[model samples]
Target: MSKQVVFTIKLEPELRDTFMAEAAADDQPAAQVMRELMRGYIEQRRQAREYDAYLRRKVEVARADKTAGRGFSNEDIEAEFSAARDELGQVV
Candidate 1:
């Protein structure tokens, strides 16, 4: 395991009491609970950033496709789906 550093923060008494109580109820230490919460929050933010980048790339590609006349219209999509439905003996 890597060497750990000490960190400290202040919290309101009420909030601290509630957090401690909840941690005790789960049979875990408050520090462990805080660590898990921090890890989860960091992961969620990381995923959100990755998703944003993916969306930006998709939008850029879509814009490039539109400029190159490679984009399809809604009517084209509907027509393609209609044709597929007919071939598969399904109702539109």
Candidate 2:
């Protein structure tokens, strides 16, 4: 099932003509071009927003660890890696 909704937009004559011209150039309908533009814009915004949030979270965690002096030694990390690799047969 599909729902039908109506939206109204105000655009200048030049932009409208430009949209139509571009649509013709692509051999696609103006509505299709508009839909593609909207979907791409929305998807890009979502990805950017999520990545921004992830970076912010990582920075906050790193800052907290820095203030608390919470860290692992290189030898400790290497030992853990070696054990996991030896057990899992995934690395040397």
Candidate 3:
């Protein structure tokens, strides 16, 4: 088991009632619902940041490839794939 910390947040009465009702409809305690929501929010934000970093790395690689004159044109890619398909006796 991990150590847990006590945290609290203030919500408007109406909003809190609504949240509790939704949690009850789902057969979950309101605290559990809030925990799940918090975890999902954190996961989504983390994934967004990771995706942004991945895009940055991909752009850097593309720029380096361009600088080194190592990239292919659309025609070049199509031709290469066509040749590979022919070699493998596969239909396009």
Candidate 4:
């Protein structure tokens, strides 16, 4: 098992009391609730970092495609989609 340590923070008395009351209402220890909250916050930050990296990679790929003349123009895309829609309409 991993060793545990005490984590301390200072907050307003009213806020602390309210948090403790909510945890008690749920039949959970205040410390356990705090730990869960901390874990959730960490996961949220990790996901944000991952999404930011993914976005950066996508932007880089798009920029590289544009640089290599492999990117399409807005008009080209619109025309292609319009032609597809017309074809579908004909089929229906």
Better of 2 and 4 by lDDT: 4
Instruction: Tell me the tens digit of each residue's lDDT in model 3 across 42-86.
Output: 999999999999999999999999899999989999999999989
Clashes of each: 0, 0, 0, 0
Candidate 2: give the clashing pairs: none
Strongest candidate by lDDT: 4
How far out, in Å, is residue 42 in model 4? 0.5
In candidate 1, clashing pairs total 0
Question: What are the per-residue Cα lDDT tens digits for candidate 1 across 10-83?
Answer: 88999999999999999999888888898999999999999999999999999999999999999999999998
Candidate 1: stretches off by over 4 Å: 1-12, 90-92
Kindly report which residue stretches of model 2 are placed more than 4 angstroms away from their true locations once superposed: 1-3, 71-92
Backbone clashes in model 1, listed as residue pairs: none
Could you give candidate 4's per-residue lDDT for residues 1-92 as a string of tens digits? 26388888999999999999999999999988888898999999999999999999999999999999999999999999999999999999
Q: List the residue pairs that clash in candidate 4.
A: none
**Candidate 2, residue 91: CA error in Å?**
29
3-54, model 2: which lDDT tens digit per residue? 3765568999999999899899989998777778989999999999999999
Each model's RMSD to truth, in Å? 2.8, 6.4, 4.0, 1.4
